[model samples]
Target: MVGMEADGKMGVHLDVSTPGYAGRLEVVEGPTGRRVRSASEKARIAAESLMPGAQVSAIARKHGATRWQIYDWRLRLRLGELVLPESQEPLFAPLLVEEAPLPRVTPKPPKSAPAKVEIAINGMVIRTTVEVEQLAQVIRAVRASR
Candidate 1:
């Protein structure tokens, strides 16, 4: 036996050709009716269960499962591969759309006229009002700072 005490639940058998009873761990169909958890999911769940203070192995023992199985489920959960139990009817009255406050829309300021800055480069149309002397001073300051 690969597990502990035998639980009489009808589990999906991983070994199709082999017939036997499983105890703590059961090979069961997943939400998609697939035979097993995807390999990545298995690894992910294993990693989560291994996280500090996560009672993964104990949970497995209590649920008649393996730590690996819980870990696989955790991985699947992360990837959103597992399907939640569906209910067509809402258990409670859903809040009406109108009851919720509409999002506040911030009005954007109107665009202003573009500012002009002039450059000394040939063929360049500079719109800046800085005098030539000021430009020279700024350039010297910039170079000095650098």
Candidate 2:
């Protein structure tokens, strides 16, 4: 129950009856093996963890990062930010779009029967309609009449 500590330090040794001895349970801040992570550095590490066949869990653990951080980095890459070195074994390519040449669909002319033939009988004029395919037959029949 001593004076207030500005560092907001707290701890828990078997001693709560001590004054100003904030205890040993407080956060230990030092430069021993602790890494001072920069936002960009973390982002880069996280991004790498999401690469194809990468050991995300191992990378995260090594960097003292949560898997969710790596997952978040993947999402951000999708939205555009981080990028892998190469795409030889890529899961997917980034967004690609093309206008498709405005759909050069020159509408074709509607097809129609190439030709037609008509045969008449006397003045009564009974007409027998025939497809263009029979034109040769009609010519032969007329020639035989001569």
Which candidate leads the pack in TM-score? 2
Choose the strongest candidate by lDDT.
2
| RMSD, one per candidate, in order | 19.0, 12.8
lDDT of 1 by residue, 1-146 (tens): 45333345566425333346333575667575334645554544455465667698776765556877786677675676753335433223456665778899997555555444454545554455554436667567545754
lDDT of 1: 0.56
lDDT of each: 0.56, 0.64
Which portions of model 2 show Cα errors greater than 4 Å? 1-36, 81-146
Candidate 2 per-residue lDDT, tens place, 65-139, comes to 778777887677677676545533444458888766676788755554655555554544334655555667877
